[model samples]
Target: MRIEISVESPQGVRAAAAAGTARVELCAGLSDGGLTPSVGLIEAAAELIEVHVLVRPRPGDFAYARDELDVIVRDIETARKHGATGVVVGALTTEGEVHDACAAFVEAAGDLATTFHRAIDVSADSRRALDRLAELGFTRVLTSGRRRSALAGAPLIRELAGRTAVDVMACGGVRAANAAEVAEVTGVRDLHAAPRRPVGSALTGDVSYAGVGVPAGSDHFETDPVEVEALCGIFRH
Candidate 1:
């Protein structure tokens, strides 16, 4: 089994490396479900660990316009240029099918490994979408079996794991507490998560830069290395 951690900052990347994760899914704005990280961040992360850059231009739905697709392609190129080992991406059609524009992303990625992001969860049919993504030559697909968390979707995840030629990386709300059960039930070897804890800022005041859902005084979140090690320990036995 391999553990993959989602990380937004250099410290998070270092924590993943220190904990010996298989790779780190490098991104920015993880609170918004992860947008593309800066080129500098990508470069810095690549130096410490195997970095798989998430090529999302913005948050929200996976359906993208031509210009947005173009930007995503460029971002893939940027990830490769900066020493990324892989790229995580996905695009869906307005009709809730896999978008044809995804081919451009793979082409731009060149020799890098590719993972279809959780966009498959919102597709018209998760099984059909996985098949199409496999045909498109996606190396893997990150999914929670169309559910909010992998544990909640174990049955569908197990079914999808059996049905696909492409690797099924179980993600979404995965944690040390449920990691072993998720792996056992879903029969998946790869688990992905951003194990984070809030760290208060030194600049304390009534003022706030926190977004919605974030508490007024919270500074930011940091990936917990202890949590990463605990999750990794589950598979060691």
Candidate 2:
């Protein structure tokens, strides 16, 4: 089993490598489900662990405008220049089908391994979408089987795993508590997890950003090395 740790900070990158993770999906702003990480973050993480930079331009839907598509492509190029070994990217049509824009993103990635991101979860039909992604030359697809969690979507993951088109990575809501069982049921060798915990931030005093309240001393999400180690231990067993 190969453990892929989802990391958003420099600390997480070091911890993931130290904890025996095989790779790290480098991203930023996990609260918004993840956006593209900075070139600096990609370069730093790439040096410590195999980095697969997330190519998402923003939060919300996967259907992107032409300008947004351009940004994603540029980010892919920046990641490559910074020493990233692969990239995680995807796009969906307004009709919820895998978009042709994905092909452009993959091409921009050049020889880097490209894995279709979780946008597959929102596709009109996952099976058909998976087929389309395979046709696009993606080596892997990260999905939660159209559900909020991989454990909840294991049946479809198992079915997709049976197909030879591409490798299915079980993602979303994965943790030490159920990582082993999820792998057992889905028959997936690749597992993606964030393994994070809330920690107090330096910000003080009541602050609200666009009506959302931030407490005097806010809290931020940070990856827990112990959690990563625990999850990796399950796969090793």
Candidate 3:
């Protein structure tokens, strides 16, 4: 029932730690679903927080090309070098199965704790993917329980947790009101939640979507300490 918070930037990491969050998944540009953080962010967060830092690589999509996977591989190496305690990544094949390429990364990470990211939902078979991750020695997999939202996904999350040795980390749509139910059903020790809204892209691409902002009613992903406290408060009892 420990609360793990994801920080999309260096400031988010500092704020999460100050709020007493248990861990920070250090990444960037979460509006596009997170990317590898800069070395400065990782190092600065490590210095400030007692909580573990889980680094993620890549900006979009789990199914990556060779060059992109190389970026991820290199990021893992760099993250470890700069004090990240763990790394998070996952990949799916063209057929929607766990990509075998990830197995090499499971080896390359070399003892920095690793979790297969939410690509679990994209896999055609969650059962097979979880089993493969355990075999590959991934410490965990972030999932929304194979449903659109964690609330609806709780059943499958619990099922997966009961069936596997690999840690099942529930995320997406997990909020203060729902943490206990998720933990109670899934029997998971770790939880990942981002109680913040998006800011802006550190950099932009040619791709454009009109009327698309941070997806927050507000303008930015400032840390919401109250949200963090409320979710942690739910598990306090």
Error of 1 at 235 (Å): 1.8
TM-score of 2: 0.93
What TM-score fits each model? 0.95, 0.93, 0.87
- What tens-digit string does per-residue lDDT give for candidate 1 at 98-131? 9999888889999999999999999999999999
Q: Put down candidate 2 lDDT per residue, 110-212, tens digits, no spaces.
A: 9999999988888899899989988889988998998999999999999998876689999978999999899999999899999887666555666442311
lDDT of every predicted structure (CA atoms): 0.91, 0.89, 0.76
Better candidate number, 1 or 3, judged by TM-score: 1
Worst 10 residues of 1 by lDDT: 207-216
Q: List the candidate numbers ranked by lDDT, top first.
A: 1, 2, 3
Candidate No. with top lDDT: 1
Question: In model 3, which residue pairs have backbone atoms overlapping below 3 Å?
Answer: 197-221, 198-221
* Candidate 2 weakest ten by summed lDDT: 207-216
List candidate 1 segments past 4 Å from native.
204-212
